[model samples]
Target: MSAHDFNPLLDIPVFPASGFAPLADRLKRIFATGNDLLFIQAEALLALEAAASSLGRPGLVAVNVVTSPYGTYFGAWLRRAGADVVDVVAPSGQPVATEAVAQAIEMLGHVDLVAIVHAEAANGALNPLEEVAALARAAGALLVVDAVASAGGHAVDIEGLGIDIAVLGPQKALGGPVGLSLVTVSDRAWAAMQSVPRFSPSLLSLLDIKEAWLDRGRGALPGTPPPLEFHALAAAVDRLEAEGLAARITRHQRAAKASRAGLRALGVEPWVADDDRASALVTAAPVPDGVDASALIDAAAAFGVALGRGFGDIEHRLVRLDHTGGRAAFGPVLANVTAYGAALAALGQVVDIGAGAAAVTAVYGEA
Candidate 1:
């Protein structure tokens, strides 16, 4: 079946009230098998709060801010916690280099923590996590990764990669509800939190949640949780594991290849030129000359394919084609490509629809 052929409902199974036990059991097993860490929200603000309290020396904390658009918020939070922030700025269109991160740590002289976003879906960039992790470890800095866009969409071995804390949300590649997030905290991270001063909102406190889960058990909690979203995330995790993470990554890679090929055939080029630096989840392309991206978005929606708009500073000149979620299916992909080609045509720009479809068909056929 094509990627778009599966029923959305088939992607997540409903768990009855009595089924919570088995579901929780499954989560426990999954965590234990992987890195034996606690799950938390994808928001780095929350993770930093927990990390600050866990590390004790808030003054010694140094955040390695990269090219992520969300770095704006993360930087604010780090400074609020009294961290000495260092912005290792990469160009908006590309990933930050590990050498830059290492240099930042060296300049700081006493680095306590290093935070990096794996894939900034907001801007269509994928950072090199393995290289960053090595630099952080060599510099004796605790590593925290925001893998919200990269988690299931690409390969990430939290423990093997030497990441102290890795955060993920279910919304992007997992094809689940958004509110539920996961954080894999290594023993090193747990120890850091153990030493930190405790100061945070009750609901946002990682210590409180970690203690409850590690001490009492998985089902135990300080207050009511987002049970439905958690259940949905668990179902998403199951689907990912069953399908095989490697295979899922390969599928996304193929889809991205097909999409880029189609766009090229239509005489449009990606905003981010380096193929290796671009993310598989989303591609940012310049709006064809004489075509208004906003108008194209409206026209594509008429065809039932929703494309993400360029965010932040890149808003007007670019349009983001998101291949994440259930829409990664072949049919949805073709629909999006065809609709986009047609939208460009409506704007008086010439495009070869046959060639675009054929490019996608070629990739899908090979897989």
Candidate 2:
């Protein structure tokens, strides 16, 4: 490869400012939202921070749902911006009860913003978004969601759910690049952002993202567009559509069900007790007696069993087995169960690896 040679593999086409809105249109289809969408140059974390920070000026009261560490991050950002944040904290790895969220909303008097994570992929805790969204609707609060881990694998209809601002990352189950954050902003959210003077133009400004794109004919992108990542995003969207989102979601659900059943055969149980309440993309569990989750994670790695670190406070206490995006298949489900059983055995815990694998196979076969 000569220095002057334009390697198509390494050198991608420059993503034009005009190309952004069209790509965002495709991304909006992921959540089935008619709201205005913005492609953030950074990860969903930064996109969320920008939205929450700008929405959290003085006199703002927010009812923040705390089911995972992501929620904690949002609450902190809102507080820093002088918002009185009411955190409805649920136990780590467990779904947030809808009742608690309603109670929080009632107690808050007037909530200006409502923030929640749709799913905690780190520890497999899924929140009750529909009910919470209803509460936010009744309160007339701007609802913000970090749907990074759930958008692809889970059913997310931002319009139907009345989400004011939804931050999504396709890297999780959408199999897209990790560098971009696809954000859908509602008219209500834009109005709220406009009221804050501190919401000025910057990398951490959601208004800047909207204005940069919509203010002047699909306005200029803030920095040099990340061409490769944009290409990766497009490719991922194409692949997902080819497979069909319904089929993709079904695959993750089957993988999760298989993982839970197989783990039971191995004398292990799910971290979140209710199967329906947990995330379909990840199967998290407590490390059995005589074994540490961190140690098991490392041991599993030796056999190429890559897993997600537990989210929030359960990082060291729990373990996550992923069945997301490209890995949400029968083959990956079987491999995950076998590796988990093998790791348990290595930790001096007697588990039926064969039986566990068979269970996984049976579950996937049923699906």
Candidate 1, residues 1-367, lDDT tens digits: the string is: 7887867555644444455445545644543435555556444346544554454356756656667666665565667656678878887657887778878888778877888888878877888888888878887888888877886677777767788777766688767767666666777777776665566545555677777665665554445455667677777878877876777777777767778877777677767777787788887767776777789889778888787787676677777778887767688778767778878787788889888888888879988
Candidate 1 residue spans exceeding 4 A from truth: 1-34, 41-57
Candidate 2 runs further than 4 Å off:
1-10
What is the Cα-based lDDT of residue 210 in candidate 2?
68
Whole-model lDDT per candidate: 0.71, 0.84
Candidate 2 per-residue C-alpha lDDT over 1-367 given as tens digits, one digit per residue, 9 for 90 to 100: 7798988877777876677767777777755788988888888889889888768888899999888778888999989988899999997678899999999888878888889888788788888899889999999888898889987788887898898888889899899999988888888888888777654547887787667667766756777878999889999988988888888888788888899999988888788989878898788978776678788987888888886678667877778888888888888888888888888788898889888988988887775
Name the 10 consecutive residues with the lowest summed lDDT in model 2: 193-202
